[model samples]
Target chain A: MGHGGGGALSAELVENVFLPAFGGRTLAALGDSAALSLGGARLAFSTDSFVVRPLFFPGGCIGDLAVNGTVNDLAMSGARAAYLSCAFILEEGVETSVVGRIAGALGDAARAAGVEVVTGDTKVVESGRGDGVYVNTAGIGLIPPGVDIRPQRARPGDVVLLSGEIGLHGVAVMSMRQGLEFGVEIESDCAALGGLVDAMLAVTPDLHVLRDPTRGGLAAALNEIAAAAGAGVVVDERAVPVPPQVASACAVLGLDPMYVANEGKLVAFVPREHADGVLAAMRAHPLGAAAAVIGACVPDHPGMVVARTAFGGTRVVDLPLGEQLPRIC
Target chain B: MGHGGGGALSAELVENVFLPAFGGRTLAALGDSAALSLGGARLAFSTDSFVVRPLFFPGGCIGDLAVNGTVNDLAMSGARAAYLSCAFILEEGVETSVVGRIAGALGDAARAAGVEVVTGDTKVVESGRGDGVYVNTAGIGLIPPGVDIRPQRARPGDVVLLSGEIGLHGVAVMSMRQGLEFGVEIESDCAALGGLVDAMLAVTPDLHVLRDPTRGGLAAALNEIAAAAGAGVVVDERAVPVPPQVASACAVLGLDPMYVANEGKLVAFVPREHADGVLAAMRAHPLGAAAAVIGACVPDHPGMVVARTAFGGTRVVDLPLGEQLPRIC
Candidate 1:
């Protein structure tokens, strides 16, 4: 049943859960959708579904992950995060405590991103029909003035930038799913990027394109951007950022470091000349401390993304034939 | 996977299948969510997930059934249909032709309601982790001015109306799931209700509440309304308006007609003074030709709903304890 039931359960979810955490007038209305005063800016809308296994993982659970994923997607489009709609598919027989923890995390996450979870739905499926819980979050954010960004805007001469270390989110989930332990607990790279992205936008308003590699990872992301923009991408293997622990984990699992997913990292394609300024901006943010100028756009091999190896071999990184990490979002 | 992949497979589900059949401008965005102008009115949003088994059943398959389900939900909120965002979860090894047929049905159903399926996603899960296919559709609509309908608005003396014959949707799925065919085919009454709702609004723009009895059926919906408004609901058993085939199916299944679902029908609460006018308008619509006045709101037994029996007995109807049809929506 939908939580709009306004009964004892709905009250528990709202009063003991949502209101104490993400309190907003529009959200408090509990309407079908929040009505916000957007000040006339065009809206950028995005939606994502979260179904990570072992619902609870290091760094965050599905609740915060769901909120952060959609918020980051909006940030990539240079939009100011605003309102969100959450839909949950819960398996029957799930512990009620897990539900509370997830709901509380959602409330906190929404407040952290300065957004409202104005509307939501909850459906219960038989234990076998579903995993533990799946969440679908959809949101609308206002794109501020003078921020023109899209994947198709990348030019041949643009420089590719990495915000931070990659493969953290991938390794973290894999470790938890397989019951593997790291001496120094490998935490998820799960984080919200509204603030960090805002800093980059402030310093370099003309940033061209931004994307977060979550499912198919950096390789798939670059391939998509290259194909969409009709340009080739060349990455310097030495310049790309990767955490030592994450790299080790990927090696142990026979996964490519470049193909491992990242939840807290973003790739930006900037005009060649503005790359220095953008890199400086990225480095100034705490979340982007490991940012680097890792690649550049090339016109000669349009629609292909080639990564140069440390041994001087260059291989084209194409879109994966199939999803390597399903339910990562 | 979480089924929001915007890639070749997703495009295949749309282009090779969805476009030629259910085409519209909004369907052209192909973004993460449907962005609509909404015609300058307050926006209305609704979402539903369909996990009905035996994907293709007597009345409809997953596509048109899902499209109609979500569209009807929006119309229940007294909104003018605009656009929809469709996300599909397909089990691996499922045939592309079957998926294409479902996509075609999606397009046709949207067209029937004068709505658009603007943006969509698709992903494949491992066979055991999912059923054949699950469709999640989120809709956005625009609420007309002076229409402030809500479940909490029902007051004493408000009239409860049923748009048409009930239990068709539930019976269709149940029979298909159990593989128990009746003497003749009793197809599910799956359809979009925008036209019927619009006609009702024309007669009484101030309708208090509207809802489609889907998963837990009419009994659950009425109980929800009563509890939400803190009013007692009284329905005459003889006035419930169930089709003979549906009643027969329910009797054989040992399920109460009131607890069975209806996809092509709606339950409306209108001010008593305007109830007749609204019913007349609903009767004019093809989808609501069997519309009837079922009950009325009462103040004496607050937060409760009771139905008078044809045998001069009465019983209280409350929300379901657990899902009646798990994963059906």
Candidate 2:
């Protein structure tokens, strides 16, 4: 289970097992999506399999997550998703009604995202061999001209901006799984980010890097960008937004908000000169109303991410060795 | 399990559950792959999930099947696969060596087919929640200009061609699973068909329809084409090739050779004028060495397939309700 935790174990699996076996320059980049040129069109291709334990959650279901997850991956590359291919693995004896509900959610989500579910496949396993349903979605999107966003593009002096409050998605799923009630109901931030990405791109196509803080969360995304660009990231912890309910829930659960996943959010590394313009654009978008300038790429301590505490002490924000929460996405 | 059998159940799932939910013309076509235009380029996209038991089979394992399945789907649309995305759902304790082996085979298969695995994802489930491994591969391919092929394009005068012998893949996996002994070992016809598709396209790009006789085998492929084209198909059973060993195994197993799965074979519907040239081209290709003109589309009894038996009687070949051999692919 740790292998899928989207932390050090996941990274190691990709680097040691998959990378060596499937040797290619495009895959070696290890970005949120692979950037490719096919028939004179710049395309971003991405794949993600969703296996969240519960079929339904506080704010959304696995179907929407399956659609939004791949959409967000493409959006991270500054691409507008054009089409998606969905494949479902269902365990025998699973109710057709359950499958119907999921299919409806998936369709609604794709339409909301303005992408088409063009091709798909379905397979069934013996009843005990699968967890009701598992969906894998692979998406194709077209990257606009002059847009080259990747982790490697982050450089010193780049400003890092975060789209919204963290920990809602993680807290929402965890609370439901554990059946823990809070004073306020927490909802998963599951959403498609294509429109928000387009708005950001409109400000300037020169955005350096974009990442959705999924799986391993904001900490992992920041650490990855820093490592890939060989730069240091310095974050002001106070500037990071955390919902009071999520903060209280995390306190009760002994989890760090920085390491919690956010489905509808994105973290961007932009040139300092365009930072204000991009932030303004993000704020104007409904999905990015809570956007904030949280950090900056620094020349010192290359390949590391450090956060300043409220009391002014600095601490390293390390890439998690394994997930604090499993199957949260 | 029947839902994934690629017969009536699978078709119903697509029509009743997926089609209504997805509500798209591209998916409604119900071909082996979906054809679309992106940035002025005609593209084919397809997805398949492989969950065959035992991991290793007589001729090939799940690895090659995962890669070749999606490639064949694209080829059915007269497209040359360019890129693939691979996602693995692994049980918690699956050996890394086992994953390594599968990965290695997948890479080799991709290279052999001249396609690249550009992006991928890995997810892990608890031990009892999953089989040892399940692989999902989604592919994108380029359809050459002036090339138009689809099941609906099969016309009344079109001649149907079978690429080679059937039942090898189904019998091979079944023998391994059931430990049934045959005098001669039956190896699966697991192979990539992109090159063969390219060869046939070379003769003429206007081939009406090309289908891989996998899952529900040649019978299902023929039935689907006939139904989609709203034409009647007449097949001479004796003209269809079946290896002697495969024939004996199916006879002992009480299975119909036409209903058995084939991984490396294709059935093509061609215009009568170009039939000879297309058949010649298929025969010249290594994958289609035993290509045979097994049938013809006729105007009578539309949406049905009838096979001529040795006893000089024509019998309706019904679409199978469910798979005779599950997970054969």
Q: What is the C-alpha lDDT of each candidate?
A: 0.72, 0.93
lDDT per residue as tens, model 1, A151-204: 777898999999988988888888888887767788888888888889888877
Model 2 score (lDDT): 0.93
Q: What clash pairs does model 2 have?
A: none
Best by TM-score: 2
Off by over 4 Å in 1: A1-41, B1-41
Give per-residue CA lDDT, model 2, range B224-322, as digits (tens).
999999999999999999899999999989999999999999999999999999889989999999999999999999999999997899999989998
How do the candidates score on chain B by TM-score?
Answer: 0.86, 0.99
TM per prediction: 0.84, 0.99
What value does DockQ give for candidate 2? 0.84
Interface RMSD of 2: 0.7
State the lDDT of candidate 2 residue by residue for A1-329, as single tens digits. Answer: 87888898999999999998889999999899999988888899999999997889999999999999999999999999999999999999999999999999999999999999999999888889999999999999999999999999999999999999999999999999999999789999999999999999999999999999998899999999999999999999999999999999999999999999899999999999999999999999999999999999999999999999999999999998887888887
Q: How many pairs of residues collide in each model?
A: 3, 0
Chain A alone, TM-score per model: 0.87, 0.99
